[model samples]
Target: MAVYTELKPEAFARVSEAYGLGPVQEVVTIPEGSINTNHRIRTPEGRLFLRHTTVRSAEDLRFEAALLTHLTESHFPSPTLLLTKQGRPFLELEGGRVSLFKWLAGEELRRPQLTPDHLERLGLELGKMHRITQSFGGSRDNPYSAGQVRSWLAGLRRHKDDEVATVAEELEEHLERAEGQRGQGLEPRGVIHADLFMDNVKWLADRVGAFFDFEMACKDSYGLDVAITLNAWCFDNGAYLPELCRTFIRGYQDARPLAAVERENLFGHALFGAVRYSASRIRDFHLSPLPPEQLTRKDFRTYLARARALDALGPAGFLALLGL
Candidate 1:
């Protein structure tokens, strides 16, 4: 239902021919993502995921293609971009760019279905990805940095809705406090999968089969990545699950031991993560013009709750909560 760009039959045929995929047997619209238009296309060869996005530029796509190639060479479990007949990573069609990837084999585990083992495996995989990306030569700044989030919040604070405006003011305070307490920024830096929500991971039984959706991948603090991931995975029903948090961090540390600096600065990073997502949800989801069928709206208040909880815990209390 998140198909922002609708492709015609001729478009599909052209894409299949260009990619050397045989006649298309089936085309089903994928309704999961919020940014790009995705479809599951079945050809005589096999099933592939077709992603079309109007918002991304050619340079961005190239960066992603290069990153995916590096990941493939490193033997990381991720989607490999299929090249066109001309050796390009994607094709231009229907006023947007389209990229094809062989469908990965696995199902995304829902929140309730996730266990400590699942979080541990996910953490290990994330840690492995961060380690692998250290050798990657590509560089791209995080598009959703603190400054960008602050700009979004500034606009939200002037909204016509009093509740939204008030919430924006509250988030501004969190952002300011987090920036002040984040320290001298001496933590390790590297490329990270900025958005590692549960849906980004696919599982084959208890083990992770793949980590996809590298569109938001960019260079940033590794500790920030850990904080964002913890926010995504460890929180449920307005609270952070202590057991899941402990297991996730333990699994990550097993792969690449966090420096003492990382441990000390995690609280600020976590608070920033909560503030960033809360602002984004309000701007991208709550205020989106797209109808319900075209976009999935996530509650901004959920992340606001996370910010409040983090603030209540304070820095020392947070480290204690994570048993760091």
Candidate 2:
């Protein structure tokens, strides 16, 4: 869960006043993603979402605000920025960046069920997202790239705990193997959601309520995007349901079919996906001076389970199960 650095009402009120919004009433903190402090605002106008970003991304709010506006205009159900009395998209609040959005209608679904219909729609919407992709929404490369992974691991070797350090070292080795395989090109590039876990997908009835958290959105591999979704949506403990992977992938492939190479690379991409989450969790659990909630709890458990499975069956055996 996101750990909010709570601001005094008076401090937050300064922002409210900037946009001439609200006879401010309540500020209720919502627990979800990292990097932002979000509060549900109850005011004379109506309920709204107030997001205070503690971490900055390559793109500023203007682009995301525009992106949301773009998605909304496309008839996608995303939360758009709300205009204040003065018609500003955001109110620069308390020394930090702050913004408001209309509160989306949503009911969080824990253990989200993956029915055939849901997968089909998800694939369609994801493809729809790609149709509206932008090239320069952000000015920096994504931190999840091969180079960044190496840089982080190099830094981690300094102060990580044994478990974290071991994972970091393993990350180093896998990354080297990945580099050796570099004659193999990455998948074709385009703007991808880059973060499409179950949490980012909201459910309102059978319809996808909205896709929130556009912060990590980036220009990256289409295959990587698929891997991100599968890593998040497919496995439960530490195994792959090729059927589930097939379902989501076929759903995507129906939009734009995967190349034979990408299909063959699926196993490696799957492992890449796992290591991404694993590294992020280890980094956050050790780094992040402002402790933010990550998937570390689930990640290490997944790691241990995968390790046990590997030990029981051996590497060749595990790959055999993956159909690699």
Candidate 3:
């Protein structure tokens, strides 16, 4: 289930009343992402996707709404909030930002194949989306920046959690070194989806459907952007798909080829991505008071292996493997 809990009509009615959205007859809770609770709200005559957050301060729901709206305005496939009788695109209430969207129409992408043609299309689509998003210039550099990574590494090196913290400390040290070597060589900053798991990219036959879940969207390095996509698309739980990487990189290049520095540091950004998700999982589940499943099941083992590969992925390694 994507939602942490079910929301009842009475509860929703309270929200509806505040926003003047009228009566809500039923509220069917949908899946809860790592950060948000989403429900499919069914009124007497229509259905809309309602995203509910636990605490007012836990999320930037308004930012999400604005981002979604901006993407929609650019003709990206993101769903826009429905208009109320008063023609408002969304309604803010005591429950947080309660906007309704016409449900995303295509089937979720499952086990997406990296066929040459398919990857080409995917890369081109992402390029167009990124171009459009860059036009907005609304967001800033993500707080989860390289500097934050460096600081966190220093903390881990202090070895606060015995064995777990020790291992983290070692890896963190390595990542810190990698970060130093990278030192802004990871260039071409722009808008990126950041979390474009194939699961988030919808499929409509041979064509691309829509990109969903703009919650993690931000401005970051174009190389880092490609790294995140590679993390999501090319690697799975246990192994890396070298062919898939080639296909995806080719596709991405078809849109905008990686620069010399960007291509060189792609592995570091991707390995960093692995550590990023693993840390989040550990912090969200083991370190926090939240329930077990509050953490996503999407495993980070794939990234860990990629991290292992990072040692061997010098410029020569990339050239030998991908002709980059």
Candidate 4:
């Protein structure tokens, strides 16, 4: 819904020619995400996905493009990056950087349609991605890590806004507890799609066909990645689905075995994952200076709700469901 930069037909046509995607027939803005501008462009050749954003540095853009390319080459089901005529992965347009991807075919599965089998397949894909990216040469530090969340909190405190101040104080306490628990155990590190929510994946024939949106990809604990998936995929109607959790962990372990430490502290990481996204949702949705129309604010309270649900199911209780 946020189209920061409007792309005229001529402008889009030029990009199409530059990328050898044939003459553009139509341009349609995708109104799903809040972060960047996305468009589905139709050309005589086929459909192409053009994403533009001024928020990312050229370095970050290059990093993302290269990561997607790597994923494709590694037999991962990700979008195919279209190269420019000069063979570049992206183009530096006047307004923002534009990257082209082949349109992936499939529909995103909604929560009501999700089953334990679906959760297991999602876990299986995540495990395969973790295994491939373990040796990936590229790395980006997580911008939404606990340290960054604290920094965002500090910025909010300086604002003198009461609501902002309240959120910061609450997040401060949660961040402190989450960070303390994070140091209790160390897990194997890899390039993780730090934000692997259901919406970011597409399903074909009731199975995962592609995993997209690597903008948050970074070098992090594989365990934390698993924990993030657990928080995102296992909860339903303010409750944790224990059978789904067990199926997910089993599927993840089917590809990459979890260490003893990962099993022992998995629930702690899930709590921190909850903290991470909740803090981010607050900062991005409420505190940031984005316009109300442009802002696609998510309910940060749901993540807090998820954290409470997880707390009810202690580490032993969570792992017991995982049959660990």
Off by over 4 Å in 3: 2-6, 15-26, 54-62, 83-95, 112-116, 150-163, 184-186, 286-288, 292-296, 319-323
Q: Deviation in angstroms for 209 in model 2?
A: 1.9
RMSD of 1: 1.1
User: Number of clashing residue pairs in every model?
Assistant: 0, 0, 4, 1
lDDT of 3 by residue, 1-324 (tens): 545545655668865665555678777666446656777776654676777655433335455666777888888877666655666555555455556676676776556545656656777777777667666756655756766766665665564677547656656755764675454544777767788877677778767788877666677876776777776776655556677777777777777767787766766677677667655544443454555454344443445566666555654574445546
The C-alpha lDDT values of all candidates are 0.91, 0.64, 0.64, 0.81
TM-score between candidate 4 and the true structure = 0.92
TM-score of 3: 0.82
Clashing pairs in 1: none
TM-score winner among the candidates?
1
The TM-scores, one per candidate, come to: 0.98, 0.82, 0.82, 0.92
Model 2, residue 318: distance off in Å is 11
Q: Using lDDT as the measure, name the better of candidate 1 and candidate 2.
A: 1
Best by lDDT: 1
| Residue ranges of candidate 4 with Cα displaced over 4 Å | 157-161, 288-295
Deviation from truth (RMSD, Å), model 4:
2.0
Clashing pairs in 2: none
Model 2, span 1-324: residue lDDT tens: 565566788876776777676678878877765557778888886788888876663246666766777777778777778766777666666556777887778764554467756766676677667665643353334668766767777777666467667767776666564444322555666667778877788878876788877777666666667767766666666665556655666667667766756655554555555555656666654455654352122344464343333334433453454344
